[model samples]
Structure formats: structure tokens, C-alpha cells
Target: MEQMTATGVSPKEVRQRADDAGMSILRLDPLNTWSRVWLPDNMDDAYIATVDTRQDRVFALCAELGCRSISLNATFPRGSMSIEAIIEDYAKICAASAFDLDCSLEFIPLWGGRPLAMAWQIVQGAGASNGGLVFDTRHFVRGKSDLADLRTIPGDKIHCVQLNDGPLVLPDGVTTKDDRYDRKFPGDRQFPNVEIVRILSETGGLNQVGAEVFSPMLKDMSAKHVDFARLSGRGAQDSHGNVRKDLFFTRTGSHRPLRFGDGTIHPCLWS
Candidate 1:
């Protein structure tokens, strides 16, 4: 679950809520506050102190909630920092949290991390055992990530796989920011989600798979009204018309086998 989902609520309360609902939080999405401010230009003594404090709070919350991983992204604009500097900062962050949990860096085409390979480079450069990558299919498709580079990453380096689909080619006048909020379900076939999933599975990186749809259409609907079962059902269908019953939406602690079009079954933990 996204940590922002429990904004203004205490970590204890958040854990209690999840316990009541029979769900476990596998990880938190995008440790937002600290990442946004952790830039090359802002690394002064005061800023470092502030960042440390924030990290303490976030780590404490994760420990309280029993979440073992947290996703992070570098959304800073291009030229704000060099790739080397970004790698250094990410390494420090990962090393700092290595004792507690995993810190996965997500690559965004519009931001510093792009094309999947560079994200892997940062993770590899970090050299922290707990440092990993968050493989989001939408960004992979939209950014035109190289398949060859995707194959090079080992299974353990990939911490999470966020599954969603979008058009292979963006429509006219639609900026990436505009397209980001409007994404299709996993089995839409508009994006090559299957091929990417297949590659990740072959490399043994399909540990955690979750449907992360950010659509304007879903904004007005309440959580209970959203049909997760339908989402899981569509996600279970493959290009060859094969459907797998094991690929249902489930919370943490409940394991499920996700079967892709290639007829390979991988143990998956849904977030």
C-alpha cells in the first residue's frame, strides 16, 4: 500500500486498520517527502539534518507496520544533478536503511531515472544489498527501455513490479504527464506488458506483482466500489487466451501463483 494512503494517521493506527481488514502492507509506494527534497543542490548541513530526521520517522513507521520494503523515485528535473551524484545519494540512502528494509528506486522517463538501464546502473553502483529497482511496466513501455538491458539485471535486484498498460504510441497532443494519470488495465494489449513480465519472470524477478492503475475514472469511486476482482480477472488473461485462476488480487501473508501467457507459474505477493 502507498504510505500516502494513511496521511495524517499514525503508523500504529495504520497497522491496526490493515489488521482489521485482513491485509498486510508489503511495502509503501514512493517515500515521497524526503526524496523530493534530497537533491544535489540542497545537501547542506541543515538539509542533511532535516533529511535524517525524516528518514528516522519513515523507518520507524515501516518498522511499526511490518513493511519490509519502500519504493523511492528521483523525480527531479534533468540537470538538477549528475547521474553520478544521484547514484551517490541513492547509495547513502540504501546503506542507511540496509539494516531495516529494502529501498527500491523507480525510474521515470521524465525524471533523472530513465530507460531502465540507468536505474539499474544506479542500483548496481549503490552496491547496497538492500538497494533494488521498482519495475513499472508503464514507464518501461513509454520510455522505450531496451530489452537487452532488462535481461542483464539479476532477479534479486528487482524488488517490485508495478503492472499497468498504456498505448504503445502516445496520441497526438497528449503529453506524458497527461498520459500518466490515464492508464489501462494490465491485459489491454495496448502495451507490451506481457513481454516485459515474461522477461522479468525468466530472470526470477517476479517476486511481487501489483496492479497500479492511476485513472481519473477511478477517482470519484470509493474503495469498496472499485472492482479489484475484475481487475485481477483481466490481469489473469494472457495474449493466447489462456486464463489463470491463481492470479487473484490478495493482500500480503496470502501467497498466489501468477501464471503468464508463457505458462510459467511464479510465486507472487500482491501489494
Candidate 2:
């Protein structure tokens, strides 16, 4: 809370800044929860405060913030909850949102929705019109899911995509945290990022593309934050001062990935 207010920045201030720059904000995140994973052991109180906030409260916050989407994911192992029960609960959460909003599910190899197939199953079973899946490239590569799995999904059902890369080699006894920190810039490695984008392109579901490169080493760099002016022109020089234009556009039209400071990435549906 102190950090949020230290710069005297509220959501209103953020919106005003975007307005001043003639840019539109699409999504606000670090807001919603993963349903079952809200109360992991030794979690921070601040995170719990946000995660434990009811769906209705979050909906109200998003409504006031003028963003209609929130980041959501599934729990790992799932403990005792059946998939049916999870879907039922998910539907109720969406129904209680009070506003028409998109609810996207991001699946990770460490979580119950490790595979896109399973995430899609839950979203479909939930039967919520606004429910969809978030296809993150690193997760896709980590899960070892076939690209064909994505090909079958309807373009509209894929709400957004996170574009990133994974290392060609995996360390012994790797873990989820390792997966998070091991992410590479798109095309910086041999993760077939271009092919992933190509598959998404064929599906016509490339509404929002985000470049989320997470690296502990990069975080330690002095130039960790992205420069918006440089980003808008073509490519943003990363912390390592490398030109990363390939992450933004393909053979497709000029598109930009919203690379938030602190190495986070969230992409909203582009009009």
C-alpha cells in the first residue's frame, strides 16, 4: 500500500496519465485470485488482502478503474476439489461480476490447469460467455503441450496471449519458480516462439500479445524498466540494451506488447 501511494499514484492518476498521452488502458491486474490458490502457506498479507477480496469487490474495483478484465489462473494439484466443482465455482464468480467482463485463465505447468486442454475444459464446462484461456508461450513450452492442442481451440475462446521464450536446456530437478525466472525474450532462444505466434495467427486469436520476459539476472540490471518512447517507435532496449523488435510485430500489422516495469506483462484486447 505504501508503494502504491508513495508516488501519489492511484488508478485515477494512471488513467489520467494515459489519457494525457492519448493512449487507452485495457486491463488492470494483480487484482483477482486463482480461486483455490489464494491461501498458500506463508503468503504475504498484502497479497492475501487482494486475493481474498470477493469477486464482487474486485468487479466493483475494476468497474471504477474502467478496465473489464482481471488476471486469473487455477490452483496446482487442486487438492480435493473436483473439476466439475471448480467449473461451477468459476461460473458463479463470473456471474457475480456485476459487469460484463472477460475472465481469462492462465495455465501453468505447476497448476491444476497445467495443460491448455484442461484449462479449456474447465472454461467450457463453466459455460460462462466471458470465460476464456490465456496462452502463455513459456507455459506452453514448459507443459510440452502440442501446438495442435491450440489449433483446435476457437479463436474467440482465446482471450489473450503472453509471448515469451524458454531456454533450450532444462536444469536438473526444475521447479515452477525456476520456470518463472527462466523465461527468455521471445526469439532469444530456441523455443519456437515464431511458430507459436504463427499458430495463434492462423487461429485469428491474436487480439492481445504480451512479452513477459522474467529473469532474476535481468531484474538486477540497472536499466530494468522499459522506456515507453523507445518501445513505441519499434523495439524497446531491454535491461541488457538489446533491441527486441521481433517480440512486437510479425508479418502482421504493427502491434506493441505492454511490458510493465518490474518485468511483468499483461496484454489487453486491442480494438
Candidate 3:
């Protein structure tokens, strides 16, 4: 589940809520805040200390919740920061989390780390065994990431797969910012979710798959109005049950069914 869901709640309360709901939080989102790691200001001593405090808080929560991974955004600001510096920071973050959980980099298009290759480069350069990637289908399509590059990634490096769909070709005047807010459920459009899933399955990166819809329509609805089971059912149907067959095993070697539409905005897999 995304950590944002527990915004104002205490870690103990969050865990109790999940327990009451019969849910296990396998991963958390956005290890850092909106401040990009590449920004010069964020590199200051004070900001670095702030970041350390945040990480400590997040790590403490992860330990409390038994969450195994955290999604780290590799957002790049307007000005340039050397790739080496970015990598060093990533390595530091990964190293800090390595003893407890994985640090997966999420690549966003029109922001930074769009193409799969660049995100892979940072992870590779970090050289931390727990460093990994979050494969969001919408970002993958909009980013125009090469399937060849996707094929080259080791399965273990892919920490999560956020499944969502959108137009294969955007209409005129539709910027990525606008388009991102209008995402469709997986298999609702021409997005190549199945093909991507098949490739990830073959490559062994199909560990954790979940729906990540960010539509205004979904946002306006109350929890009771949404039919999570139907949504997950459709995703499985669209994939022809390949998702069920290729479902991932947890670190403890136990198979847990992928529950895409768990009512959480982002349902993740721990493995």
C-alpha cells in the first residue's frame, strides 16, 4: 500500500487499520517528499539532515509495518546535477535501507528517469544489492522505453509493476501533466498491458503487479462506490489469467495472489 494513505495517522494506527482490514503493506511510496534529490537546494546540509530524519522515520515505519520495500522517486530538476552525484546519493539511500528493505526507483516521464535505461543506469551504478526499479505501465508507454531495454533487466531488480492504461496516442493539446490525471483502468484502452506483462513475466520482473489508476472519476467516488473485485477480475481476464499463473512468491517463498484492486491506490508485492 502507498504510505500516503496513512498521511496523518500514526504508524501504530496504520498497522492496526491494515490488520483490521486483513491487509499487509508490502511496500511504501515516495521515500522523499516533493523536493527532488537533484535540486541544489536539497543538497544543502540542513536539507540533507532533513532528508535523513525523514528516512529514519520511514525506515522505522517500515520496520513497524513489516513492509519490505520503499519506492524512491528519481525526479530531476531543471538544472543539472552530475549523474555520478545522483548515483552516489542513490547508493547512499540504498545502503541505508539495504539491511532492512529494498529501495526501488520509480521513473516518471516528463519529470525525470523516464526511459528505463537511465533508471537502470542509476541502480546499476549504485551497486547496492537491494536497489531496484518500479515498472509503471503508463510511464513505460508514455516514456517510450525500449522493450529491448526492459528485456535486459533482471527480474529481481523490478520491485513492483504498477498496471494502468491510457491512450496510445495523445490528442493534441494534451500534455503529460493533463494526461496523467486521466488514466484509465488496465485493459480499458489500447495500452499494451498484456504484452508488457508477458515480457516482464519472461524476464522474471513480474513479482508484484497492481493497479494504479489516478483518474478524477475514481477520485470523486467514495470507497463504497468502488468495486475492487470487479476491477481486479477484469485485469485478470484481460491478461487471460497469465497474471495468476505468473504470480510472484514472497521472500519467504510463499505464493500470494496478486490483488490489484484492493481498494488501495497502490497495492504492492513484497518480493
Candidate 4:
């Protein structure tokens, strides 16, 4: 989110581009809902500013674009906030929004939402009708979560799905920071990308599949946009079973490496 805003592109420009290209914004990001209620005692004023700015601007932009889905992950590290406090904060945010949008909690293994189970717990406790999960393949695998557990979740509660592949083994002495920038394209490694797509299909309620590739290598390429679209299409075709690969190309919000029908691409979605 910090870097996203630093792209020097205005929200109004993004809005106009999406409108011009006939794209529909389906989600917003890391809205810093926590800033609305509380933050860890250790966070500094800069962190507060980043949180508030991302939230306020994204919220207003979503309203302008009619994007009703917001994706949130942990702003700080795990144990920075208690489960009870997080749920309470989420409930407050949801209530304050007057249920205008659907919100999903994305679990990142090394981040605050360290595992899938804990994220599910927060959603269950919050008990907000519009509350749900944003399942990302990298997070799911990194957290060492069971794919079978996904069956337990009501498909209707799955607000979004992201697909990506990573190395079969993490690099020695690697941190989450290292893991993030070193991702491989889908099926370029050992991730069960096809199975995940099939499972989400069976689970139902899928509106689109997000192709998220957060590679620093890709960022340096002059033709990275073209690569993202080509890889997204290849990945989707390789992964899609009975599901149509075209479903993955539909307009959405706040997902990475998102390719539009007219060839515009959203590079990365980081917060």
C-alpha cells in the first residue's frame, strides 16, 4: 500500500483508467481498519500516518469506484493485537461502514495472521455477515495449512482467491521478506496450483482468480506488464479444469498482476 501510493498515480487517475478500460473495481486493500480503533503500542507516528492515509484514501476511492470489497491483513506482527481486540475492532469497522462493503481477512504466514486457523477464528468471533476470508495460495502453503480445511469454510464466505506458486523449498536462512520477493510464476515450481483452482471451483462462490506474483525480478523488466498477462493466462489455463480460464481475467480490485481485457495490468498489491 505504501509503495502503491508512491507510484505517483492519483486515485482519480486510476479510477478514470479503469472506467476508460471498462474495468470494475471489486476490492480495496489493507484499509488499515485497525487504525480506526487501535494500533500496537510500539508503532511510531509514521506507521500511524501510513495506516490512516491508506485507509482514508482507499475508502473514499472505493466509494467513488463502486468497489465494495476490501481486503485486510495484519498491519503489524503477530501478538501485536489480541484476537478479541481484533474482532472487536473489525466489528466496529463493519458496523461503522453500515455494511456497504464486504471485507475479507487475508492470512500471511509470517505476519500477524500467521495461520489460517487463527484468521478463521477472528472471522467466526466477529460474526459479521459481510466478513469473510481471502485465500492466497502462497499464504496457505507457507502457513502449512491443510487444503482440506478449506472445505469446512462456507464458500459464500470466501470473498476472494489468489493463485501463485513458489519454490519447493524455502531458501536457507530466508525471512518472510526474502520469501515474498522470490516468488515463481504459477506451476513454474511445485505448488499444486491446478488442484487449488479445482478445489475453489468445487467450493463455489468464486467470482475471479487473482494472479499475484510479487517478484522483484519482474519489477525490473521493461515488458513486465506483458509478462504478467502472458503468465496469468498460462497459469490460468494450466490451472483451470472445468472452470473457464476467462473467469480469471475479469475486472477486480486490489489483487496483484491483474490483467484486464484490454491489456492493462496492475503490477503488485502490497501493503
Candidate 5:
């Protein structure tokens, strides 16, 4: 079993650990949540000046620091920021920067039970398909996405796959999204387990499955002791096995997932 540890380490340190562990450090996931929280999505010249100024600084800093890709987990500004504006801004950033956008990961409120693919379309529809998706397991499952959605996707369309877990029971009022991407490691409140891994392997083409966890909890537990390396190792092994199991089941007739109106496939969620 290979292990990658970036405990209390800078990007350089973490990247080194991944390399030493024989793991290819793929996404340099960054937090854009600061934008939605810091400034209004749309702004006049003065506001644009201030925000763009900061944006340029961020690009420069990330490049200088050796961080490559920036993850799009940004929320709306302080109160109510427009999703359209935020997405456009994300696109704009990608356009100006040297960052390699394999594809853009759209941050969304749970649409039904997972991040909205329709919202993802917003990125593609808006011409931001630098590639495909940087899908997150929790966000996808929480959006209530089924495995069938994979059928329509072309093989090379999937960009990156982020691996993490959460609980089935959601927090109060949010029957859909967990609103806690910033939280840490395996066993989240609503992270899809075995099935989540499978969907990516099957539909997403399994380009780059990574352990991109973000939790305040990691501060207390050093890399040497963090969750004792559970999710990335044994947990991943089991999850991968389950994915294979699903494929095995697919060979049978009755166990097949249901079909959408357009004949697109989706899980036959019988809950």
C-alpha cells in the first residue's frame, strides 16, 4: 500500500511526500471561497479594480509558491452573491492566469442530493470547458446524483476525481448538501462510500482519484497520526473493491439502474 503525507507541510512538502510515496500530485486544489465571502460577485470599475487587483495577486502568489490548479470551492460573497457572477469570475481568472484548467469544478448548493450537473453545464454552456470535471464524491452524492449519469459522458471528458467520505444523515435543514467541504477526512456526515468511488471509475474514467480533504480537524492530528491514514489506504482499497462489485452486478438484468426520461441512466434510489 502506498501512502502520501502532507501533514503540517507547505505545498512543497506535501508534494514531496506524495512523490516519495509514488503518488502523482495532481490537483493543487485552492480555496476560492474567499471571493464569495470577501466581495460581491458583480461590481463596478472601482469594485472590479479592487477585486481584480487581488485576483492578480492570488495568481502570482500561487504560481510563485508552486501550486498549480485552484479548486473552485468558493461560496457567495458575505450575504447573497450571484452564482452566475461567481462562475464567470472563476472563468475570468482561469483565462488570465497560467493555471492549467483541466476543467472547472462548479461549486453548487445541493441540487436534489448532489452538486447540480445542470450547474456544471453552466460552466460548459458558458464555454469554460477547459476540460471536464473535478468531481467531489460528497458533493456529487449529496446532490443525489446516480451512477447512470456516467453513460452520456464521453471517455476523456472527466478531468479529476476527489475522494472523501461523509455521513448519510445530513445536517438540519440541509436535506441535500452538507455545507462542509472545508471539513476534514473520511467519515463525513454524508460522504458516499463504495458507490461514490465506482461512479467515478466507471463514468469519470478514473483519471485522477485523490484524497483532497479539508478539515480544521487536521490541525490537531499531525500527518503521522491523522486518522491513522484510514481513507487513502484501507478505506480506498475497500471502496475500489465495491466499485468492482457494482460492475459485476451490472452484468445482470434486474439489478440495472433506472433510466431517465431521455433514456439517461440514474440510480434506482428506492428510499
Candidate 6:
């Protein structure tokens, strides 16, 4: 929180900065809760209460932080709750804000091989026109979806996308989606980032292209933070890296995955 306040930053400040910097959207991350996997089944009741409280805190914090949208990393046990129930609860939580915050689902095929194509259909069927899937390049790959499948979605149906690369393995073998998700930035070795970027380009402006490749390796790099200015030109360097780091470093390791975002998606694609 101190980091947020020290720079005279607040949610409102973030909006102003984004506007001044020529950005239309701010990307907000929700904390992931995959740790539940390790907890003993006997502790379910206690953790449920605890998790619920934390979940409330998270929603309140996002609103308080002035975040207009959030990427949810929730993966529930299939029978634990139904998607309808989850969406209803999620809507109620996000609606806590007087502002309409887009509620996007982080589809993890970790639990089972649920189709990305099918999930989007369900979201659309559920009348969640305001919501969409958080499309991670690797996740989509693992989901084994072709770019053509994306055309079926109303361009706006894809809420956001996370860009990254990985081995050309099919999604069937991957046990949990989180393992693939918690990877380093786009051009890092061990992933198909370039092709994924192409897909995102075809789709056009999403809520954000979170270059959220984990930075554990670069935790100690003096260049931990990137210099967006050095790469600026007609670009003027937006908040996210337009550096367009081709898969050059993809064979090498990057400290962090690059991140990108903009508020609107190209509507004409659907038309």
C-alpha cells in the first residue's frame, strides 16, 4: 500500500496518469487462490470462512483502489459450486462498486479439459455480455483453440488476454492451468509467445495484455523495471511495453513477462 501512496498515487491518480499517458484502460489483478490444493480437507470449514473474508477484502480493495476491472483466478472444484452460482456471487461482489467493473473469468483447464469455445458460449448464454474470458495465450493453446475459434466470440466477448509462450505441448497433459499460468514474461524461453501475440493482434485491443510472466528470476536484476522511454518514438511508450520484444529473448530467460493493456477491443472484427 505504501508503494501505491508514496507516489501520490490512488485509483483516481492511476486513471489520470493513464489518460495523460494515452491509455484508456487500467489492468487490475485479483489474487490467485490455488493454494487451497495443499490444505487438508478437514480444514475446509475454517478455510472457507477465511477465504470468504479475504475474498470480500479483495473486492473492497479493488474498488477502493479505483480498479474498474479485475481478472479472477478462481478455479473451484467442479461440484463445489456451479458456474451459475459462481457468476451470480461474482456479479454481486463486483457490483458492490457503483461503477460497472468488468468481471472476467480466468479459465483454467487445470481441473478438466473444459473447452474455451464452450466456456465463452456459456458466458454468452448466461447473459454475461459485460463479462468475457481472460484469454491467456498459453491457456488458449492448452485449451487447444484455433484462432478461428476466436472469431465466434463477439470481439468484445474476450475480456482480456495474458501473453506468454511455452513448449508446443497439447493442453491435455497439463494437470492444472496454474502451472502454465505462473510463468515468466512473453519472450522467455519455454513458450510460443510470438504466435500468441499474433492472435492478440488479430483480436486487437483487449482490456490488457498482461505481460505477467513471473519475475522470480529477475528478482535481483538491476534492470528489474523496464525503461519504457528508451523505446519511445511515435509510440511515446504507453504504460505497457509496446517494445514488441519479438521472441528473441524467448529462447533466453526474461526476468518478467511483458504486460500490455488498453480499454477497448476492436468491435469491427465481429461485424
Candidates' C-alpha lDDT: 0.67, 0.62, 0.68, 0.65, 0.46, 0.50
**Candidate 5 root-mean-square deviation in Å:** 10.4
* Candidate 4 global lDDT: 0.65
Steric overlap count per candidate: 0, 0, 0, 2, 20, 16
lDDT of 2 by residue, 69-155 (tens): 776766445354677777876787767666788888777766566677877888889888888887888778777778888888888
Off by over 4 Å in 3: 1-8, 33-53, 219-227, 230-243, 246-271
Cα displacement (Å) at residue 223, model 3: 4.4
For model 5, how does the per-residue alpha-carbon lDDT over 1-271 read when each residue is reduced to its tens digit? Answer: 0112224445456556656765543344444433434333443566344333344545554554454555554434323545566456656655665665343454444321124454455456446546355666666655665556644565455665565555655667754323454543433334544455555556535554445565555566565443334332333223332222233111112212212223322221100
lDDT of 1 by residue, 116-199 (tens): 988888888889889899988888887789878988999878888777767889889997767878865565546666666777
Judged by lDDT relative to the true structure, which candidate is superior, 1 or 4?
1
TM value for model 4:
0.74
Q: List the residue pairs that clash in candidate 4.
A: 1-270, 1-271
Rank by lDDT, descending? 3, 1, 4, 2, 6, 5
Q: Ten residues in a row with the worst lDDT in model 5?
A: 249-258
Candidate 3's residue-wise lDDT over 1-271, tens digit each? 3334447667767788889976677887767542335433324576444334367777877887778888887656523556777788888888777347899998877566667888899899989989899999888888888888999999889988887777898999988767877877666676777677778878777666667777777656565436543343433432322244434222111111233333222222121
**What local lDDT score does residue 111 receive in model 1, on the 0 to 100 scale?**
60
Candidate 6 lDDT over 1-271, as tens digits, reads 3246667776567667767866554445553442233222333475454343244555555666566666665555444656566556545544443457676766655532145765665466546435667777666666676767765565566667666555656356555333543454455455566555555455553445444444354454343134331231213123453323221122333333333332121110000
TM-score for each predicted model, relative to the true structure: 0.75, 0.75, 0.75, 0.74, 0.54, 0.60
Query: In terms of lDDT, which candidate is strongest?
Result: 3
Q: How accurate locally is residue 60 in candidate 1, as Cα lDDT from 0 to 100?
A: 72
C-alpha lDDT of residue 36 in model 1: 40
Q: What's the distance in Å from true for residue 118, model 5? A: 3.5
Give the runs in model 1 whose Cα sits over 4 Å from its true position. 1-8, 32-53, 219-271
